[model samples]
Target: MTTFKKSFLILMLPLMAFTAAHKFYLSVTHVGYSEKDDALQITTRLFIDDMEKLLDERYGLKAQLGTDVESKSADEYLEKYFRTKLLFEIDGQPAEYQFLGKKYDTDMLICYFEIPKIGMDKIKSIQIQNEILTDLFDEQQNVVHFKIKEKKKSFVLIKSDTKGMLNL
Candidate 1:
């Protein structure tokens, strides 16, 4: 084969492989909410593109940056949308995830409750886990805060808080 033809085939092969892999990843991800436990529980994955579009549609604001925009503006917009939209649920029930009552040095989102009553004694323990992308501007800041709860004598147990990092 000619040199030019061989080089062209090699480059196109890798590019086609990359595109296929990306397509597979997107298909694996969940876009809308999924009902579990007979509609008592729901699990959903929020994509960055969906988040940006939702913010624009709901609040008439854009969180993501433009092709040729300032970084500071983009950061500020994303932070605001994240702070507003990130949430958690247990057994298909909504629970408070953002701490509205504390001032912190960093841009940390806190979800509290020494113990939240979800209307069932059968629930011996409840675990709230969240995966959020860290802020681009503040490397030290996290999108979620998991606070430790002290031991108390009760049939209902509220376990320790667990924090996680989400890579987008």
Candidate 2:
């Protein structure tokens, strides 16, 4: 190969790969309130590949998430992981999370949870501590969105700031 050709290839290949690849470690957690049910509905979306990696490294659970080769106990592992890594607090008190279920959207695993007996009016301030993937990924970002009644609040938590407080 010519010198110019090799140089151009080397320069463009990494740029192309960087642009094409979207392997950013991120998770989005949405928390909303239900008046009728008096529940705080929560949904967390995580990259399946990222989750699988953590599961393998930390829990030794080989979950082939978002694939046909996924393990049968994938949900169980997910629940366990979330329970350990995610925490919620209302009015400086610990809140319980009911793991509803999960569904996959493309490469993301969207898990659902609910804080029952909690109404929007009753919440003075909502604090969320999400350390998911932070230990594994130094630059991991956990975006938390709260839709309590008509008020909407958002917090972007990084490895350094794993906990976010939103006053509603």
Among all candidates shown, the one with the greatest lDDT: 2
Worst 10 residues of 2 by lDDT: 14-23
Each model's C-alpha lDDT? 0.34, 0.89
Please tell me which predicted candidate would have the highest TM-score against the true structure.
2
Candidate 1, pairs of clashing residues: none
In terms of lDDT, the poorest run of 10 residues in model 1 is 24-33
RMSD of each: 13.8, 2.4
Q: How many Å off is the CA of 59 in candidate 2? A: 1.4
Question: What is candidate 2's lDDT per residue for 36-103, written digit by digit as tens?
Answer: 89988999998988999998998898988877788899888889989888999999999998999989
- TM-scores for every candidate against the unseen true structure: 0.26, 0.86
Which ranges of candidate 1 are over 4 A from the true structure?
1-7, 10-54, 57-60, 64-94, 97-123, 127-168
Clashing pairs in 2: none
